[model samples]
Target: MELKTVTAIIGIAWASVITTSAQKITMYSTTPTERWIEKKYSPDKSPVDQADIQVYTDSLLQDVIGFGGTFNELGWDALQCLSAEERDKVMASLFTENGTLFTLGRTPVGASDYAFGYYSYNDVKDDYTMRNFSIDRDRYILIPYIKEALKFRPDLKLWASPWTPPAWMKVNEHYSQKSSGIEGTDIGHNQLDPNRNVLGNVTGFKMQQGYLQAYALYFSKYIQAYRKNGVNIQMIMPQNEIAWTPCWPSCTWRPEDLAIFVTQYLGPQFEKDSIDTEIWVGTVNYPNPDYIRTFLKQKNAEKYVKGVGVQWTGMRALPTVHKEYPSYRYMQTENQCGNAENDWSALENTWKAVVHCFNNGVNSYMYWNMVLNETCKSAWDWAQNTLVIVDRNTRQVRYTDEYYLMKHLSRFVQPGSQMLRASDKENVLAFRNQDGKTVIVIYNPKEQEYSYNIKAGNKNFKVTLQAKSINTLVL
Candidate 1:
């Protein structure tokens, strides 16, 4: 027989043996304008080159807990702009089991950077007893948002972190690191307690002398109070970003401070109170593995910290911690805030961010804001991206590209989904859900459509990827 005839015969045999679209796989995608747009395509059963992307079904990596976003004051304000029916509709989109079914949430312990104003649970000076601790602001704002979310998903889990300790607990007399410079508040000291109409004589600095115990008690009180209010907070991070020092309400803590507190103060205090909440040494934004290493060196450090929560630069330390300590669970505590464009470009960045985090052993991914209004403005004059945007003037809710980005992951990848260690030539991550289905997310960053290949178990298929699109393939 001629060589050409022999080659054609081999190709026909390969096509017959390969898995085709008849195998019944689903393709869901997101474009610049569309969110969770479903498409149908059959896998090519022909002989393909090795250059096509190959996903190995047997190579499982991590078990994903879930995907979610923050419940901040800014997000609350944006949510309130909509009518009650519209509000429920939006909440259902994010929290309901029929929707994204996001089971995890990130909440600020008191006042986060995106808080409406600077305040703490116990701002009163010399209030060591914490008799004045109250979540009145939360009742009016953050609680209502959380309560509404609970209506959609009663199983939502929350982890609380503080941007700073109470004003009297930090270095010198304030919660913020630098001066707001608006009169009484300065780098050296905060002038007075406006709520009490009294000057802040409660002095002496950052978790010093007797302040560590008091501040730890403050966290305990906040957790207890939230529990009393029907909010089941499951975890607590001693600090938001131990390395960050901003003019806003923030505190800069050394590695030892984190170690000493978690191992010595925070951990023991929670135990004494019999609080089931786990302590997390986060939402650590620092990238240095050394800081995490330093904390781990403390006696019984692992006893207190059940997980590591990282965001932004903290990603650098994540894989390292996971590599060294696989026993501890890891999470992307916060997604990087974008420029509030809420466009395809920003969503692409989010795609890369989630991929990177999951590839590095982060089991859960959390976005910064679920919704922000037209301004997308922060309390400190900054703007960041969000999943939904509300137009106050029109009272309209617009889902952004990032919303689809979240949808692509949340819709298909459920809690307890085991990520597959799929080798990627096509910028993809594959995972197997609890139901024994295979899911591969392909992110095409190129300017043109690219044809990719997948090899799962003994079956092989070919996929055509569009330019700059996120495609989820489920088998």
Candidate 2:
């Protein structure tokens, strides 16, 4: 989506009030004391514990692209159980301008650990022509959820990642990996085969001549298929996590092979087919500096890659990657899914993650799953966090504190806003919106109340941040 359209959509959605000459400052917070409370601040003076914020016009970072959550199978399944009225309410809360109004979406290209069973669109053997490719599974659940979200904002941008390509494409011919704990799988010492140079758990596609072309075509065909279904996917990645060998849907690729497929096949295919969908280089995890540097140093690295996507352990190398590849767009693709047991600390870590991702060079931030059943458990037997949880027995949909954390920023922060220079103290971030509004998000992880000052643009204010709070102030 273009910035002009983004500004128009968000402007109508945000309903930013203009004062002709002066700017308006509004505060929205998700703290222990208050929920999604909105407070209008007097920019000229301080009402409470306001601080002096200093703004340096010359120092700026990447422009804010957008915010959203993943459209996982589990999330869709949970939504399917919601009553019509409740479902509409949930959609509005996420997609409407008056609610979270998220603009970006992450989708699984095939299956993830979230799916009930392993699956791929082109499961047929020797189907290099991709005649068997179909998104029929998505139609039953995931599509409906995405389309419903589109009802509120048709321009919602989406990107997809594949957890496993296809059994026929991989060396192991296994749609999923045999992790140590999965039941009824071949039992043995699962370890990386150094001699063969393949992951023993779940080897990725055989890096052969014909397979590479077919796989690239698989992606292109998928894009065309979605467009035929009236959905436009804006970006795509080849794999979910290049380094993991999990129990469920997964494919592990050597860094060299991944880079080769992108530069030689996927990149050129997208261009040849005239597909507008961008090729982002991640959803990759566990960043080994040498691992990522290997890909970046490839011949067509600059030509094929539009951005880098990171999650979990990938955040460790985010600074180095951002510093080295300053020209490429960077995104925090997956917000770390906290333990299913939702608590104050989970919310705290989530808040810190948002700051951490943006404070680095991430232009966009995406949560893993939007909603799950009460347990927030995945098909892989592990549990995770989401914006909301639903109870199957009573058909009750309950919003979590994390939902409010998203509202704190997505509710007011506009796309195209630029992250401004701020302190590296780990909890505070400031941004300048395209509409000229200044936004400040402060997260206090401590248990005690603390007061601080944010002085910017020659205006000073004093404020007291509550303990264990997630706060966002818009000026």
Candidate 3:
């Protein structure tokens, strides 16, 4: 679908209202009394915590927090999953600044694994005629809902990624069954024996390093086309979850292949075309050590790609990866738990996501299938977890507990906020910003509540965190 997403740069100003009184207002907190104090803040401060801060001028937070929703998935049975009015309302909710929900996106080249079916811009019809291409599939469901959502946020910064190349581009030359986990009768046989090359899918296009370069340019053109239609395309990932190519929907590209494509092919094409969009790599399995090691080792690969996208299994490998590739941007590209055993499990996933990523040095995060059919019916053929799942029969979209947990961090913890070191003596992870603001998030996976000291600067406030809860305190 040709969904129009707009993005704007919004400014925030502190209101002028001050009261001079010794009156004390108290709320429940498990935080110790020695961790609060005023500090300095400067925009140019290296490691932000080192800057001078004007306590009164800056709030501990800024901007609306956000997550991605697959319009195709969410609006699949819109009339069934949500009333026509509720659909509009839900779409509007995404842009409400008070809800602090901002950011809209699109997959420039193709559908993601969470999608109902596999698709791309230049699908192979009869033969490989790349020039005779069109995004015909999206014209039906995904694009329409996205366009409607944009009506709410006229200035939504849109970014995109490609899940897989056209079936014609793979070694199997067919999109349906993949090598990773796809188990079905193969419609097309692997043309070559031993099919062990890192570039597994050797098609007319993806089969060669030079063809990969062409594919990059093809993507750039797609972005430009979208821009012509008023949607601003900001970034691109060469491949999504390149490490463990899934069968539901995915593609595989080894570290050397990615590096060769970036340093040798994609990078030059972007320069030649003057494509302003940034390239990210390894939209890889998050928390996986092998992918990180492989991608990081690729020759001068980091120079071209802006960030390493962590998703699914990739979440476990952040610490090791960050230590080596500290210079590149670390983004939580995709992660969620829709089918979590219970609300607590979902919240735990959120806690693990926010704390682990920030503590390990990830800057941004994105969730998969923002909304899904509660009953799990879509092209990905499988539904594990999601933030909002609507019952197709009842048309009720319930916000899971993870939604609230995400809010605690994403709503208050603004982007560009430097993650400063702080003590974690009580199973509590915390970070202090340059603006004399400290965000201490406590995760009590155990059954009992835990109280601890968060000493920083000169002032510390006594705090208490609920048992089996995630608490974020700004001091």
Candidate 4:
């Protein structure tokens, strides 16, 4: 979408009262102590600073796909602790226009580490044709969670990725690649032989033709089954963290092997089955550019691969990969999970990540765990940060600093908004929505409040940012 430039009368007096008919700038600020406080300001007549952050709306970049969080089994399980009304309120806060207005969502195909336990749609051994595939297990947890979100925003776009393929398809024949030594988790939780914990240049999934073909069918059946259940998956990533060997549900695949799976089996099967869901290579956690290049350089990769899903260490490789394949879409698939701190520092880091991705050319950014129990402990014993924390004992919900940080962007930056070019200022982002409103987000990372002069076209305004706070200005 092209951004319409605003032509206005120049030399407007500073400190003039904004008439009702005139455009008024609204500012939303969130600090460590306060959250989402609103204020109003008129155009400043103050002299423009030489260091003013300039937003070029006419010089538009990528169109925003949207912003969202993942839907996990444990998130649903945590909500079960609340009353029906409370649960609905939480859903509304996430999916409703009155709240964050998240337009995108992600779901795991089978199980992520956040699931109550490890499982797959088809656990039947050697079901090469995927005849035994079923999504019945999701009916109890994931389906209901997603249905509630759809209740608020039926048009929410969703995508899916699996933490691991079915255990039967992997060479180790285990759901978890290795056992996490955390208390209460050990060899019993994971059956993979200790000696088989090889990492680099390994293909966890069996490289046989039957297993490859069946895995492809497994993906097809998953899409069809979810569609039958009222949830439409718009895209699919072949794997999550293709190079990581975490103790949770995970699979490692050499880039070349994955490229072959996409070109020979998964891509062809999707075509024969008439599945319109896009195929993306992703949830990549590796930082090596060569790792991604190996897959993209494969013959016919451009034909099937729609985009790249990057996160964690993979963010380091985004600039090089994006520059090389400028036409392919890119997304920040997962936000880095902190060590369950959920403090101001963590929120600041997350803000930096959001700014980095949007600045680097990602169309969309996704948060990891949207809501978790107060303990914030995963089934694999990993504690991670979340936007909201539900206290099982008290049935209380606490919105974290990160939640407001997301709201500072997602609440105002509508889907299809064009990312506006902004000066290379640290902790600043600008976007022009389809409605022609420009939203500017800035972060004050210091202990002292900072003042910024924002120049957007003929309009020049000054905003006072609170200490250690996030601010969004909507014009």
Candidate 5:
């Protein structure tokens, strides 16, 4: 994780200080609250690493103070989707114990479009019969990757979701990769469609009244399988992007249908199976407050759902939703391809995605496909748009500016740490925590350099933000 560094002369009143991206420290005070820059007192300083700077102060230097929750939804599918050799390089760059890349990831239950090819955990006989199911797919690679990740953060929280169920479970008679012959007919557990060769061999499962119960059983099997392999899942999104009928590995459900399935069947099934994982609904692409309203408005919605997961255009509408459902926690589940021209438009769009969601009460933000090829190829034909891209030709993985920008929050702002409010300062985004610790992450996505004042506690610091650059200051 080598960063670009330059010796720059920065001033604080009559004092001049040398700063670099590698090592930096800036101080400001309208009225010096107190100064303690030691290895132990500074919240930013590392306790495990013996040689890092520490800083501390006591008292609210300013009155404009606020805090919110923080978490991440990073990607791990690319690792599973790529060839073993290619996946290794991606892991080396991002999944290390001290890696600067990302910690959290999103994984599929079955063969997602991003995977090397189509497959599932239990590919044994009677996949949908719920009679003789098994998880053989994980032992070779998936579980190993998870074990390596646990070495970094033993308590790492994982949020699991599926793009598509097994070929035996869909009403269309096959998983996403295959074409649907019959439009609206239910594929029963005993039904085997020989014509759907797209998925190799798909014996479509029955969509009987007990389908929800069967789904619950499937989920239980998945949890048990992963647990046996020593991975504890924290949460699960009912389905990914349930609004759109995707080109590959997709499922669609109306808001009312989702509410009913979750509240009546899935929720109760989880309780019965003793699976403590939290159930999040509406992994919708955009923030459709109407959809959220539909779910939350369900007679006893609060009892069944943990929170709402949204992405894309939906994130833009969070402020309005936050005001209406302040009680419900919202999360930016997934997003990608934000004009990767390495410009402010890209930076500003990413910033807006983060701060807007946080300001409007979103506790977590995760990007799509954490690491991609140098050319950024995908089964869906998606291109290079990851925070980190692994170049196959050179066999070298490169980090993007977005990686550093996300670190401004993901790395510094620990889980359970609340986000505090300061001011947006037009382009500069500001947030603080309950402990009065503040992280003002700013980016000059434009061509011209800009300056802003961040007044916190009794301090007013002038920030000179360079164009197409990112800055994060803690006070």
Candidate 6:
């Protein structure tokens, strides 16, 4: 499919007048040539066709936690390239009530693939006492980025997870699991000696008591330090992608070993320190259901885990895992990061991902890389897509198609909204806010414009959707 215009139609229907033709509805559309153009329409007095979509307001599902994106070091550095006023505008568009109103955010505990370089909170070898543990490095980049967002929305919920543990705490004694260069490049991504022990199928983290105990202390200190800095990290995932052994700052974990660590060390440490941060099992990137089961099936680990986070291939495991563990909260940890194209195809994939996760019972959804420089390349030489891009030379900021796609839902779907049942046709999603406002988001992929007859509660209305566009109707 070609990258075409996306038109969003927002309608407000009153409960009293919903069944009458006198009900006035407003429409707002975004096209490639024009963005968020407003028009007016009224309920059809006489209809010739059956309802194309049926919304069941009585059938409510998960309560939305909210929408958000990650705060990466590169994203922050990209914003630094823009003028102060431009930077503020971008921040406002992301977090302010007048904008997308993102209420949740994810931050890396230490170095992620997007970081300027590989490092950790405590690099001192075998510091079992954790006396050297400090977030002094975060003060330079991550902390400021998080603090700025808090300025716009102080209650913005934050979660954190590390790409890898400190080098000394790992069996490989390196920040990365791989000893070789990235697949397509000759550049070695880390300083791991090629002759030394490279992490294999085993858990990269040392399973000994001393390492496990100190690592748990690492997590507690992280939470305490962030709280001291006025940024309350509400959640912490044990690791980011336990199955993948990437050349970047990464660590692989056997599910059984992770279960043991969380059960005996991480969980008990948090309880001992009186830290209120919730522990979650994720951001799982593997497709195998056994990885999740190996963790959650352990009753002790399940006791401390409040939720599960899934991303990439892990999405395939979400259905099975969620089916078995329905009571646990679920989240789409990271949206698939495309190849920095930021094109319509990527937007379509994002929409499909959003639908799949919400339909499968995720309470919250998160996008990766909120912003990036024009090059879109990470410090480790990997290129990825982002919602906003800044041109370093021109000092210009541009919001990609994904940004508007996110706004179509996040701007209308408030935090307390409940997911309402809607017919599976036409890529439709329905939600009802706490204030009794109903929101229907639909996408028309056909080349020809189609008119849809919608049934909500006892009321019925018709909306004509644009060709190859996404529409949001609010009532």
The residue-by-residue lDDT of candidate 3 on 38-64, one tens digit each, is: 222212111333322222222232222
Residue-wise C-alpha lDDT for candidate 4, range 263-312, written one tens digit per residue: 99999999999999999999788898888888999999999999999989
lDDT measured at residue 241 in model 2 versus the true structure, 0 to 100: 81
Model 4 stretches astray by more than 4 angstroms:
1-21, 46-49, 182-188
Backbone clash count, each prediction separately: 2, 19, 45, 1, 21, 0
Top model number, lDDT: 4
Query: What would you estimate as the lDDT of candidate 6?
Result: 0.85
What is candidate 1's lDDT per residue for 129-159, written digit by digit as tens?
Answer: 7889888889889988998999888988888
- Residue ranges of candidate 5 with Cα displaced over 4 Å: 1-103, 122-129, 177-207, 338-345, 433-436
Residue 187 CA displacement from its true place in model 5, Å: 27
Candidate 6 is scored at a TM of: 0.93
Please give each candidate's TM-score: 0.88, 0.88, 0.75, 0.94, 0.73, 0.93
The predictions' CA RMSDs to the true structure, in order, are: 6.9, 7.7, 11.3, 4.9, 12.0, 7.9
Angstrom error of the Cα, residue 25, model 1: value is: 1.1
Off by over 4 Å in 6: 1-22, 45-49, 181-187, 195-200
Give the clash total for candidate 5: 21
Whole-model lDDT values for every prediction = 0.78, 0.78, 0.56, 0.88, 0.56, 0.85
- Stronger candidate by lDDT (1 vs 6): 6
Q: TM-score of the candidate numbered 4? A: 0.94
Give model 1's TM-score versus the native structure.
0.88
